[model samples]
Target: MPSKNGTKDSMLEVFVYAAQDYGYSIDITLNVHGSLVTGKIVGEQEYFQRLSENFKDDSSETAEKIKDELLKASEDAKKSDNNNVEFIHLKNAQVYVGDTQPTPSENHFLWRGKIDDVNGFFLGRIKQKN
Candidate 1:
């Protein structure tokens, strides 16, 4: 599933990195409303840890807090003054296989093509990683 803000087929590219404990670093581009939003997942391990703590204690409050934090993170990723780039951090991601079915386990590790949000559509040069 794309981020709350991504539009269909608007996503152009993505990058991902392994984060700790069922988490990952994800980047995506999509058109949200009318703007292009580029975002990256940050500090995924920390986010999952918080969620783990909450689940361990069965703390509804903590879960709610986690949700709020995720939304904030998404918003933070979408924030851009120039209206071109956005960044997002996603944790505890539920990855799927080939758009067929949800992966067997939420904790199962995989690199995901995801969209956490979108703004407008823009084409920009991507520098190759050295």
Candidate 2:
């Protein structure tokens, strides 16, 4: 989903903070899929390793929470018309948040879901009077 009223930036900040906590970096990419807005978040190998370690102790509850948070942010962006202009004709789009350190080089996705009503996620800012 795109960001509206700086919400996208805010969400990125959250991801950056979380990634830093685990000593990893986050890579985000936005793409246009027909009239839909698609997004991908890639967390590197070290991050995945740490996440796996945590999952062993907590059954991936933390990872689930993070995924939920990201999904929620996407949903919120959709609701607020904060998506990219190319998505103007689409009602929703899919987002993938994954780790690159998949075993056997497959099954790398940590979270995958749809964000609805993405057409509204890219409202432009209005100029203010001085």
Candidate 3:
């Protein structure tokens, strides 16, 4: 089912949360508000874990605070249900603003966005050029 305003696809929610419990992932391309975002759907635990690591090298207080928040959210999400889950997380995600593909960056990053914002989606990832 496609996502609607303020509501996410229930099937997608189950898939994402399952990834949290198990370590399986599926490549997906989401039509998000007229934009295409391609990546592997990841669990909240993995999402927060990666985000926390990204800030580990920074010793700034703000970074620490962010890390703390991520930790809290991670723990909270572990107990989340499909009805309560708010966001979708992706790994190695790349964004295409319109019909044309943008220049692919060498770096891939973790991305998190509101699940309700996704209008449609498909079951494959875009292959990047070398």
Candidate 1: which stretches are off by over 4 Å?
A: 1-59, 81-102, 105-130
**Per-model lDDT:** 0.38, 0.34, 0.80
Q: Which ten residues in a row have the lowest lDDT in candidate 1?
A: 13-22
* Model 1, span 21-77: residue lDDT tens: 234555443344543333344443354334444445555887767766756653453
State the lDDT of candidate 2 residue by residue for 15-83, as single tens digits.
433432333333333332433223233223223333344344454677777655555544454344222
Could you tell me how far off, in angstroms, the CA of residue 124 lies in candidate 1 after the best superposition? 22
TM-score of 1: 0.24
Task: Tell me, by TM-score, which candidate is best.
Answer: 3
Q: Comparing 2 and 3 by lDDT, which wins?
A: 3
Q: Which lDDT tens digits does candidate 3 get at residues 33-72? A: 9888899989887899888988888999999999999988
lDDT of 3 at 127: 78
Clash counts per candidate, in order, are: 18, 9, 0
